[model samples]
Target: MLWWRQDDDERETDDEVEVRGRSVLVLISHYFPLLEVLDLSYPLHCYHGAVELSHLKKLRKVNFSGHSDINDKSLLHLFKSCKVLEEAIMLHCFDITFDGIAKALRERPTLRSLSFSKTNGPVKVRYESAYTTSHFISSLSLKCLASLDLLSSNISDELLSSIATERLPLTRLVLQYCIGIVQVLGICCNIRHLNLSKCSMVKLEMNFEVPKLEVLNLSYTNVDDEALYMISKSCCGLLKLSLENCNDFTKKGVNHVVENCTQLRKISLDGCHKVHANIVSSMVSSRPSLRQITAPPTRTGAFSARKVKYFLRQGCLVC
Candidate 1:
């Protein structure tokens, strides 16, 4: 095959060609059939549903994030074609619709990690109704689907609640910048890590127990002292808690968490202007389980600086 067809004038300089467009895809599908990983992100030209990856049976991971040409037809093609497809990261793929995503999931239910951040929203959604939407999204009873990230999308509470109720084996859920999510009442018993940062109105409360939760991030959210209490009562196995930039909670709420979460190891309170330095010092002294602390900006005296060093020497990171 002609890898690089440089003209006579440019023969002296071997300018590396940018591997993009449908030609490169055709070559990979035909020649490199045994390729296990495929990344067709930010392509210079649109594939326009002209490629096939069915021959690449060993394909495990693929990234099509930020590819403008990725529409429903192309997405469905990939999922239906690749039998052993495990993980697909399609972040910022704007043309993807709810209908397309639902169909894709059905085709390749073995997907362990899937991301659809910054995709099409309600105003631009095409050929989808509430009934059809539920029919597909609820079909997310996929066996191996473990991690689901829907950042900066327009997913509503009802739909999100459905995913919660489906009882998928989700271990990590990142819903950062999803403004539609205000509450998740479903007990995320299997979730080991959860991030709800920048989701301003999210309240941390669930009906059932959260026995297996290990990490929780509520940064820049409207989570109040009451929310902290709810978490402390529920997620007793929580290992890390991040409340960065949150001002609604004071020492009262923090005390509940530090006291109740016996396994709590790491806590980040950076940009929390309300958390007094004294409270932090108290936590350092009292909470012996803490291994790392991201404290808010504080005016440190010589004695306090020495104490911080002392804590560091004692196998804990305080910064």
Candidate 2:
């Protein structure tokens, strides 16, 4: 059975080519019984197939991003049919609603990763639906779900609180551009990788703690020095951190991170003009495990140039 298809550069025009209807999917279902992955992302033509996807029991991952026709009904059909589905990526699928997602999560116990990010539709309707969906998701027992990507969505602190209450064993979570989130609270302790990049309004609450967190991205956010200190104290296991465009942090804040987060191996200070070149150089010299540091070019001074050269000779990748 063909696992994937590569589109040819030269294809026949409509007059010369045979247009396949939705039955093509049905035919594939019968033929490629072992197909584990299916990607109908931005299909060349609209698919009007009402084919039962449940028949393809072996299907594990599915991507229907940019498919305008696939609505809540299509999702429901997939949920009821594909019993072993692990990942569902439906970015920009405008027709999907809260009801469909809630039902799917409840039915698919094996689902571990879901990304409904960047679904731009009607503004008022989307927020209302997203709020309801988040509430429903928080109430469920999703032990198998480890990764969730909700970038550019209307997620608020309420959704975060719900996830925390459930204590879902999520290891990776992405909430970039979730503008409604003002202060983050009630995050699960199991989260190891988190991306809150571009969430400018978000401020890390005092009680926030993620003991097992290893990778954290707070670039372009409003997080101040106090927030950084709190994170350094709480997330001592952090290995990689990004503070790009966080102008609020100065040398003191950066030093706090370097001292408290002893496990940090990589850090980014890009666009943070307040964090002087000398402090960055000293950080690299002090931390033996630190291997990579991304920051703007150092000011052209005799002392700064010597420090840069010293770090380069010490085998650190300074960018």
Candidate 3:
């Protein structure tokens, strides 16, 4: 009940297209100037020549993941061409070094989001300064960035701190499995959604606060009950909290969240074995604003799923 098409005419290059194992991207970019999204994350060698992609003025999103042949020069050139680009997803792109990123960020001030997962290639050092060296990363400033996602990368705390210091209007930040980003920069007060799942080495004090945070995801992190309590007290308007696999949460922490975070809508307690199931149930029952709680599908927990369903069906449910 399916079919295949290999011809260029048969391919749908109007909106978005997946080009793999080929070299026609050079010509395709010239044709699709109005394309809003492009996925070049295939295991292919594309754009062999120094093609000028400036023709794509309307491009908004681009994915260059898994393109092993693209060196830093090619990547930089591509990013420079797409000035209207908003989101860029680069995964497994081993050719992009730190200096290459610095160059792109300096040029594209309008970029809203940059997602780089497992893309830290050979360090093409531009200078011999240390990472902690002041102003080493100041040149790489994105003024309009609203979100940043770096998964499984070698992002340093200095790098994050520098970006936060830029006072970029960032609202959402996701750093899943990124090492060396232990201390969250405090100047990121405008952040609304933050996901730091699977970053195990991150330790925190009670000083960090995000006033505008609405959603938080810390699954599999090293944060304890004190961290959660601080966040609940600081981010009072938090709507969603994902504490899955947190090994330190107890009944007291859960009660604080229920009593203080009056706007919380969803909470995930999957694999938080330290937390009592009855406390979770009580929190849900007390917080009428809560919509859902994610737990293990097979865990024989004390919190009855049927009881939660009944509460949600009742008139006490809040949107």
Candidate 4:
């Protein structure tokens, strides 16, 4: 039941305290069996304490992100102990390899939201193989997993294709900066919120259908007018869309979205040079449901600015 640390007069150096404090915490876990939520993220070197996590059967949510010492063995111990675990965020835990991640997923079928991105260590040799990564994702049981974030990872298009084929019941997926994904050929039909920002290789002809999609972000990508048109046509239920720095799109693409995506309440066209001022004005006039529209100051002036002001007066947010 010891909750507080010793007085400052008796405290050791930071390194010694951190190392020794973790050991104390692990020892305390043996006494307090009801410990449910544990966050060992940032600055806490839990290389040894992680193994002791198996003792907390009541643990539900855990965050082990940015712990340099957390490896597959630590994860194995965690999954083995926290069978009822629901959410686990392990971003930048460099020591965790794909094998460890796969094993954890297999053991904890109740994980609903999981993030393992940016976990690749400084040493490139520790990176997981594409095959192992793909196998783990595809093999995930479709009962509990609903949200997954894999930003800045080395996941390839082949793995994406496998995920598409598996069609797991994922609702939200983030794949920002995943350069290896060149196309998304209708793999995630059930996805409602999707972010593919900075995926430079995704081109105009890349075909994909996500009918239930509501929120989509394709910022800083190579998505052109044709691709935007395709998205508007397919994801008609889209409520929020961001195309920031997507310079390949023009007025034609914006028009398609304004015309088709009637459910759209918010849209961002910042850094888009070809979407003229008049087109934006036209869109504002047409789409009464539009609440927020973010565009460059140069393109949003005179008529567009006046329309935005009017919307603001009417209690809508237009920027």
Candidate 5:
């Protein structure tokens, strides 16, 4: 995979040739077969031209993350050229629409994985209505997809349902900030890492069987103590858990974790306010196999006269 960054110099170049004096035509004329992945990232809102990329018949994976200028029209152009393309990650490129994505995926049958996470931008006249709800729903056509990361991308319910019932070959899926994902009643059969942080739903309420999941991050979500209890009863293979900022969890949730998920190696509770320092200390010392634990800072209480004297004796040290 080769990662390319677009710059203003690329845009200022003469129309006769691209910035590098090499277009997709030149690439196709030379290195055609060995190319598997091509990434064009960074320098936001860049017009990285991909209209000539149609020549690479063997191109599979393409990443356009962090490119704000390349919108639905550019994506359509790229997809029209690369027929064999599989995975495409377009994080922060908010100029995509349902019609464009659906048309492209429908035309390209070999596409597998499609990710659009954290694709947000400032208010602009040209790219105002780029990311539509329909565009997310259009992502349901890829049946061969194995992984998807739509974290913080404002996904919809129709999209999640498509993944659950579309007979997908998905293995690794992330739906972070997909506020509509209330129940995995039908999904989560083969997911490996399922992250639903900052989602809208208060309760997890998963009824489907996902025996293969290894990592589950539900931090900043609406899951309460009862929901955590249910997850502790299920999801035996969960290795890493993030329950930070979940206001509903109390000591009950902590106790549930201690009893279940004996193989958990890492846990993050940075913003969980209900958890006390004593419980956190116990978990840190008791869990022999625990590798990492992230918690928020603590404040000291009113000091006694003896404590004040001790502080005076042990002055602060500077490096």
Candidate 6:
């Protein structure tokens, strides 16, 4: 049996390419005994027969995103099948539950990355009355977890807080379109990259520490000047910031961040109707380190074609 593959082939792109039927899945396990990665990410997938890859022992990563048939039992079976599974992405797998995830965590303590972003529906706790909800969620103590994406997943603040308490050294976090979460940055202090776009329920209040943070996305959220100020104060090391379509903040908030985050290299403000052309231009002029500015909406006057070309020539891009 192949313990590990040296490189990835074009056909098996981390298991991304689709397979038509259950027989194919079983055939893969039988022929390619050492299949380390499998990605079956698709859209609006109709239910199919289940063929658990239980015979495999070296499977490292798998993507079950957009599969409706892989429910709680199937998720546990998949994780248990892989001996050294490092990453598992089950986005839009509506049938998965917190209980399933809790059991799955026990089988993969070395998992480095996990995403349960269920866009189809919310993941719930099965046998709700029997299991302690907090205990079930707190079981997400993956010893090596680093990157987590819960975009559009209806997870409560308690579950998020549990991760923070575990103090897992998470470096990247994405919760875009997750309406249930209220406070993001507080729980993810160690995260270097964070995406909170379209999370209207978020409220940024009080000062916190996330000094290691480098990238942040607040596009289409309810972020205002006060929140921006707090972010500027907390994450001084931020390099790339996106505030696309965030109408609450004006030039004042933008300038505050620009002046504070000296290391900021890229700022994207596309769809922002309130920000004027001059503000973006001023950002370019003031910050020598600034390399790119995604200018505000065209209605607010995006940089002219000539001006864009001129700026690009000078090592800075304005568009």
Q: Which candidate's lDDT is highest?
A: 2
* Per-residue C-alpha lDDT of model 4 across residues 147-227, encoded as one tens digit per residue: 888866766766787777767678888877665676654666678988888764664343555679899999988888888
Per-residue lDDT over 1-319 for candidate 6, one digit per residue giving the tens place of the 0 to 100 score:
2321223333443233344455556776788878788776663333453345777678888877778768877777777778798988888776777677889788878888888765643333123322333455577667688888877766566767777788787898888777666666667567899888877578865476789899999888878888888888888898999999889988888998898888999999887777776786678777878898888876544567877776776668887
lDDT of 2: 0.75
Q: For residues 1-319, could you state the per-residue lDDT of candidate 2 as single tens digits?
A: 2332325564756433224534567777887777888876766655555344557889888887777677777787787788888998887776776557877677787789988754542243256555685666775777899998876677766677778777878899887776777665347778899898987478677575667999999998877788888988888888999988888878888878898888888999888877787676688867767878886435754345666677777766777
TM-score of each: 0.86, 0.86, 0.81, 0.85, 0.76, 0.86
Q: Quick one: best TM-score, which candidate?
A: 2
lDDT digits (tens) for residues 228-274 of candidate 1: 88898888889999999998888888899888898899999888877
Error of 2 at 12 (Å): 9.0
Q: Global CA lDDT of candidate 3, please?
A: 0.68
Worst 10 residues of 2 by lDDT: 14-23
- Candidate 4, position 253, lDDT: 87
**lDDT for each residue of candidate 5 in 109-189, tens digit (9 for 90 to 100):** 677788875444212212213345545444556767788776564445555666665667777777766554546534647
Model 5 Cα RMSD, 1 decimal = 6.8
How many residue pairs clash (N, CA or C atoms closer than 3 angstroms) in each of the candidate models, in the order given?
A: 0, 1, 0, 0, 3, 3
Off by over 4 Å in 4: 1-15, 27-32, 44-47, 119-128, 203-209, 299-307, 313-315
Q: Candidate 4 clashing pairs?
A: none
Q: Please state the error at residue 145 of candidate 6 in Å.
A: 0.8
- Tell me which of candidates 2 and 5 scores higher on lDDT: 2
